[model samples]
Target: MGIVWRAARLVERRPQTATASSLVFVVPGWPGHLPGQHVDVRLTADDGYQTVRSYSLAAPGDGDRIELGVQVVPDGEVSPYLAHDLPPGSDVEVRGPLGSWFVRRPDQTEPVLLVAGGSGVVPLAAMIRARSRTGTHSPFYLLYSARSPDEVWYRDHLANPDPQVDVRIVYTQQAPPGSTRRPGRVTRGDLDKQAAQLQPDSPVYVCGPTGFVESVSNLLIDMGWNPAAIRTERFG
Candidate 1:
């Protein structure tokens, strides 16, 4: 599809964690997108200096309105402003619903495994919501890795009890109270337990920082998941 820049206004904003936020924008002419799609946000300064960054759509499409989950990169050029300085009614140029290979279509019926690190859960969260939104019964297992309990995004949505989707969290820095697993990066043992619920052919999607994605993807491949079947997206 031929995508062009469009005007988007921040209609609402909410904190997801200490360093992250969810921004809701209402674009006048947003083309609906699939789960895992992202948009390019262009920020222009007072002197006309401009910069752009890509952010995955945090929510399933709803008319001209969309949501983005942003993690403040302490020294980043754009993220800091979007997560901290941007206010309701502010205008920013957006151009996307971009990306293709990592998306999940609504009609897909096979079981799915999604592994996310830190804010990487943003897009996977959209996939989970899209599943529920369209009434698709495909079973999903989401294993999320965050630095600590307070850093997990979409806390309520992931915690909501659901028989169809199994959600798990691994803390790399601080584990939640009474949690069994001590603070650590995800390991083969973790995958062993979750992989038991899935068949050999089930598709797996992994997203996170470049290093985290690489580490998780290698782990999945070692566990007999087909290399071509494991889709991945990485940032930073």
Candidate 2:
């Protein structure tokens, strides 16, 4: 069946990082979605003006509940509302569980490499959660890049011990005290090191802003990773 717009109630909200928050909604009859899917959220003002924005699902759910991690964009419309103004128990319009290419299937046994920049980690987080929920032993590595330790979404949750998932945080602007690496963008060396942990045929999914996605995807191609094996989704 085609996806439809439905009214969803904001049931819970939690702060993920300094600039991001995780919003959970209760949607009745939310046809189950796969990891890496996104939904379009629509908001309306009292004057009947409306705006819509798409957000990736942060975790896989059993068709009744969905989570989205929204980063407050400076001077943004929807994001600011989602991050701060919206209150629990408020109603929002949602449409989707969309996109098909970037999704991860549970039966696949190959290693998975997920790379994210800034808020782009949202969909990748769904894939990671799905892997854990299904009890898949496939080695999964997440290379997440943010401005600093404080800006990394789900930092505490990513800290939770999971032998199957290996997370590496790359700080671009600032690094915590005593950190060995200098603050910088993710380098070819970083990708090389993580790629070594997975097989040559392993699928790589990269998500982030346009420039970040372009740079990473090009680097993966230059690294001899098969172009077809690298799936990318760009936002902003």
Candidate 3:
């Protein structure tokens, strides 16, 4: 069956960072979504021009309420509206909860590794939330890279200090004052240390800009992780 576009009302908005915000919608009859799935959003202008974009679900939720974390793009057609202009109670068209290749199912019990860059952490965050929500103790580790500490999304949520989910932050451009780690991209050494924590069969999910995803995925392959066990999703 074709997925129908439904009007979702914006029920709440929470700021995650200076440029990113989490938008929650009340969608009646929303089909449940697995962690790492995304939704296609469409916005129409007054003159009838419309634009569509895809954003990952940021958290696991009941089928009725959907959440998306939007990062404002300087010249983007849709994201600007979503991040800055749209008011509460506004209605927008959404279709999806889509894509299968990148999902993390509830039944997955093996160790899991997630790597993210910039705003690409969206879906990976969903996977973490799903793991916690399902009460799975299978080890999960996240190595997230961003330009600086302020640009990191969901900082507090990631700071939960849960022993079951380990999150390591890497700053590519700048680090906060007094930070111990030098500012740089994710290196082979970083991956090696984290990879040692996982079983050989652990499922690895990498999401980020095309270049970042490619670099990390290649590193994992070089580290002898199975290509079949690695899943990736790339964004701008």
Candidate 4:
């Protein structure tokens, strides 16, 4: 609901992977946000040139602090700065808590199926965090895909055992030593395993690049998931 441009100062930065990082911004007077909303980050240069890019929130509401996960685009304008150069006290302008289609509220008690690819895991991670922060007991199934073991964001937290959530990590480019799954994109069998854990009316959220989202969404539909019950947000 917040559409005004607010001052956001970087409070912390944590490396998520070799090329991605999580940026914590303290936006004073930020109206709390839901699980999957995104914000527009605007940067103004000394010459009065400005550029804006949208980034998904990496966590749920926590007072005035908002977290964003950024993946560097080698030739892009904004991502590189957000991921690497912006110092801890530097300020930027943010306009958000935008998009409602992919969000999940804290009180929704149905089983949840989350499918994330590459850096798209940011917002879904917010949903996971929200479920924990609010102490809800809804069942969670997360099927995450990355290019390699090293590119997995929030690695330790996702790997940590949680009684209410089931997590399966699949690699597309390189599989680590002793890994049971081969290096490839998520196959039908992956969704098959998760599909069994959810009920007929349970909601599914999918986020990734356009192709990955399209592929997974179609597979879920073929495997009997209701298209209307599946929410998707795609990038690139």
Candidate 5:
């Protein structure tokens, strides 16, 4: 059976990164969800042709509402429908906290490397939030990439730091006029340099588009990190 939830109300909807919207939903009596699990969003047309899309939940298990940072795909039917048609008070039907394959508790002493590309930063963001909220002492290193400054999701949240988090922003497409942006995607060199900054035996979490995930995963492999030491989640 599908897990069902009612949209209690829209708390906030704002542009996170370029072409991405971060939405907070308050479902009354909502069951909390894990960091990386996603919910299937069900939408039906007036003619009854139904469509379901799965999106990862970016909120932690706080016993509160759920949050989703949706990066609307260009020419995508379901995302566009939700972005444009769904209003604040409109109740959305969702089935989740699905997918057992996700990141969970790790050693508080093991340094964490969180890498996010575009909207793939959603899950990593959730982990960061959870760690801070629970007062875990894990050292977090975030290397987030976006097309440009305007597209970097959670820029404000990252810049305004809690004592428990450390974050960096990388841009591949357009850097500020006078600034130097490392050309292309996150490279082996980038991963190596960042990994060197941390203590040995650190755990890594990688999220982003499939290409980003694959490339970073391979780079981590080449850097002498065990496949088990790195965790990843991907989106189109």
Candidate 6:
């Protein structure tokens, strides 16, 4: 459905990490959404320069409200506005519950491997939430890399990495004082370790900044998995 009205409040805005905010809107006439979908937001200033942007849905839908994970880009047109100008109880126009191409369902039995870079873990997090909600016991592996411990999104929930779901974090810029996972970049060797630990038949989902997604995807193909078995989404 298209956006006929705007939300009354911005509702809730919470920062997940230093660079991103988790926003939930209590919009009336809200339509349901799949985990990995996104919505287009239209922003207008009083002076008449208008802009529109698309952002991924952070939380899965049970029907009422929609949640978005937004990263504040310095000097970015939309992000900065969201970070500074837009506030809880503020009004904005959004049209969505849109995008059919990227929705994920865990109805099948295949194990899922999720690889993410920086703030790009937004959508992949939703997929993980979906798997958890359905009580599906499929094995999941999450390889997320960030610049520092403070920069990694979803860091808190990953406190205990289960046998079925593996979580590995890499710090490219700097690791905190005495960290465990290796420092530097997310290399092919890291992907190899994840692949080795996972069952051979699992399907993989990779989302992140362009370079990390490309590098990881290439590494997977080079490691002998079929190209079609790996799915990807890039967030710029």
- Please, what are the lDDT tens digits per residue for candidate 1 over residues 80-104? 8899899899999999889988899
Off by over 4 Å in 2: none
Residue pairs with colliding backbones in model 5 are 18-151
Question: How does candidate 4 fare on TM-score?
Answer: 0.98
Q: How does each model score on TM-score?
A: 0.97, 0.97, 0.96, 0.98, 0.89, 0.89
**Overall lDDT per candidate, in order of appearance:** 0.91, 0.89, 0.89, 0.92, 0.76, 0.78
TM-score of 2: 0.97
For candidate 3, write residues 1-236 as lDDT tens digits: 67889889999998888889899998897888999999999988899998899999999877789999899988877787898779999999999889999999888888889999999999999988888888898888999999998899988889884688989998999998998889998888888878999866689999999999999988898888889989999987
Compared with the true structure, what per-residue lDDT tens digits does model 6 show for residues 119-218? 7888878887777777777777888888888887766777664557778788998888888765787888778877886654467878888888898888
Candidate 5 vs candidate 6, lDDT winner: 6
Residue 134 local lDDT, model 3: 85
Sorting all predicted structures by TM-score, with the top scorer first, yields: 4, 1, 2, 3, 6, 5
Model 5 Cα lDDT, one tens digit per residue, 131-231:
77777886788888878888777777888967667787777888767766554688876666678877444678888889999999888888878788788
Better of 1 and 5 by TM-score: 1
Which residue pairs clash within candidate 3? none
Model 3 off-target regions past 4 Å? Answer: none
